[model samples]
Target: MRLVLVRHGQTDANVRRELDSVPPGAPLNELGLAQADAAGERLATHPVTSVHASRATRAQQTAAPIAAAHGLDVTVHDGVHEVFVGDLEGRSDREAREHFDTVYAAWWTGDLDAHLPGGESAHDLRARYLPVVERITDGVHGDVVLVSHGAAIRLAAAALLGDTAETLYVPNTGLVVLVADPAAPSGWALDHWDSAVPVPGDVTAGGTPR
Candidate 1:
């Protein structure tokens, strides 16, 4: 089974580069809607069995088309939303961005415990995020698609594929594919990371890393 984690399409908040991490967060803008449709088209070729989305409006909206194309109903799941940004909930200022970048970069450096001013740390994200991934992908016979936020996907993917798999950027509607590795201890392996350079793993896992 492959765990196909996807970032939801663009939003006004995304355009502003703001940290909109809460539930019912920004809806997909017009371009985002188009992107979602395009994503649906792109992923339609995959052998997807289940479609799931975070609590955010944008994620669910992004998921609708994919589910429709697959003849599947998207199952909404809790505890799978974006990493909470408590005090930094809606700021895009230089200071806020700098602070977030510092903390997030630390996560890549193995400091998962680093916390946001009043938000969640990379550790916090894994605690609430991975179980949901486990649950959604548990005993699945085919691929699973999860529409979620960029930062959350990056953090959790690193944890899932091991600490060495960290990389930046999860473009809107881009995918992070983790194929099940029943032979490996983690039960998953990095198959591809869409659009990110210096791709992790063997880079031979196939299926369009671009």
Candidate 2:
């Protein structure tokens, strides 16, 4: 199976560098909508059989255009949501950097056990997210696209690649493609990690990276 993990378009929280995991709301801003549309146009060439997104509005909005083009409804999965920031949710970057020193340090260093103030730990995020990924892989018979948060997608890529979390910090709207062969021990191989704004092209337009 080919799994394409895509980070959602930028949100107000992203622009302001705040942590936001509020559910069913926080819709995309104008720039975010444009980004989503661009992403969707690029994805239109792929043989995507399924589209999945976090229940968060940002993710849903990101996936909507693709789903509409493909005539598929996005399957909302709660497990794919961004890590809960809890008390730190609405804080400005400067505020968080000042008050949540330990958490910020841990995040910068990719410590999975590090917990945000009153929020979920990176370990906690992996525990929930990995299983959902497994389920998605198991159920889908072909290529799949998953629209999710920046942190969640980064951590998920880390888990899948058997790398440190620090090794997988993807930018907003980043795309990571992985090919999984259920018969192999490791089962999955990283195909590419591309961040260039995807342009309209034939499915075979881009070459695989070495």
**Which stretches in model 1 have alpha-carbon errors above 4 Å?**
196-210
**Tens-digit per-residue lDDT, 84-183, candidate 2:** 7678766655566454556534754767788777877778878989888898888576679999876677667777867632344455566888888565
**TM-score of every candidate relative to the true structure:** 0.91, 0.83
Model 1 lowest lDDT segment of ten: 201-210
Best by TM-score: 1
Point to the candidate with the largest lDDT.
Answer: 1
lDDT of every predicted structure (CA atoms): 0.81, 0.71
Model 2 stretches astray by more than 4 angstroms: 98-110, 164-166, 182-185, 196-210
> Tens digits of per-residue lDDT for model 1 on 132-205?
99999888988899998777888888788776665657777889999999786776789998864422321111
Provide C-alpha RMSD values for all models, in order: 5.9, 7.0
Worst 10 residues of 2 by lDDT: 201-210
